[model samples]
Structures are given as structure tokens and as C-alpha cells.
Target: MIDIDPNGTGLPGIDQLRVIVGAVMTVGLILAVLALIIAAIVWGFGANSSNPHLASRGKSGVLIACGAAIICGAAVTLTNFFWNVGQAI
Candidate 1:
């Protein structure tokens, strides 16, 4: 048989989990933005400027650009997700 708490005392448990989940999402978005900035810097160093050794870094930058794009997408998604969750309350 399924069990249910007679007095609905489970709120604290549920509330704590939501708080933690929200904190995790906030951290994730922050890290994702930082990674995007780092990737942009790498891509910029690779694609722009006139130095020869810096030229070799272009490929790495292009890869970094791709990574930044992906992280940006993830950040957008996470922001929307958290926004929606917040609105639901």
C-alpha cells in the first residue's frame, strides 16, 4: 500500500530541494557565462590581430567559438527554465 503523511508535513523537504535546485541553476548559468567569455577571448585572439604564433591559435579559437556558442545556448535554456520555475510559484 502507498503511504501518505497524515498532516502534510512534507513541505520543508520539498522547499529545501527547490531552494537547492534553484541555487544549482544559478551557479550553472554563471559558469556558463564565464566560459562563453573565455571562449570569446580565445576566439578573438585566434581570429584577429597580426602575430604569427597567435595565428596558430586560430584553430583553437574557432573551436572555442563553437564551444561558446553551445554554452550560450545552454545558458539561455537554463535562464528560461529557471524563469519559468520562478513564475510558477
Candidate 2:
């Protein structure tokens, strides 16, 4: 019988990949926050202008921005969760 190491994939640069992914996620989180702020400003303007169409679009933008933020914020957690799941397989 051969012994297998679960933690040994013999793959190189995994740490570097993790670092790159982390940096990308950080940038994405920053962009999502910016988008959320812009959406809020647009919502305020639409509300003040009393434009239903603009207001509706702004509302949708806010939802999307929030979703983006959530995804970006949870990226590391999600990645680790999936990684653990994979390892368990």
C-alpha cells in the first residue's frame, strides 16, 4: 500500500497565487465601495429631482453595488470554505 499526503500537492506558487487573489479581492472591494457611494449619491439626486425613472435606476444600482460588496467582502471566506471542501474530497 502506498501512503498519500493530503496536504502535499507538489504544486508550486500556491502562496503567490493566494497573495495575488487577495490583492485582486482587495481592489474589487474598494471598487464595490466606490460604486455603492456613487449609487447613494445618484439615489439622493434622483429623489430630490422627483424623477421616478432615475430613482428606480438608482435603486437598482444600489442593490447591485451592495451585492458586489458582499461578494467581494466574503471572497476570502468563500475561497477557504471551498478549498476545505475540495480537500475533504
> Which candidate leads the pack in lDDT?
2
8-85 per-residue lDDT for model 1 (tens digits)? 455568767767877876776567566656756665675577655665565565566556556655765887788779
Would you give me the overall lDDT of model 2?
0.84
Per-residue C-alpha lDDT of model 2 across residues 1-89, encoded as one tens digit per residue? 55554453467887787789889988998898888888888888899999878878888889999999899898779978997897677
Residue 29 in candidate 2, Cα distance off native in Å:
0.5
Task: Count the clashes in each prediction.
Answer: 0, 0
Which run of 10 residues does model 1 get worst, by summed lDDT? Answer: 1-10
64 Cα displacement, candidate 2 (Å): 0.9
Q: List the residue pairs that clash in candidate 1.
A: none
Where is model 2 poorest over a 10-residue stretch in terms of lDDT?
Answer: 1-10
Clashing pairs in 2: none
Model 2 error, position 8 (Å): 6.9
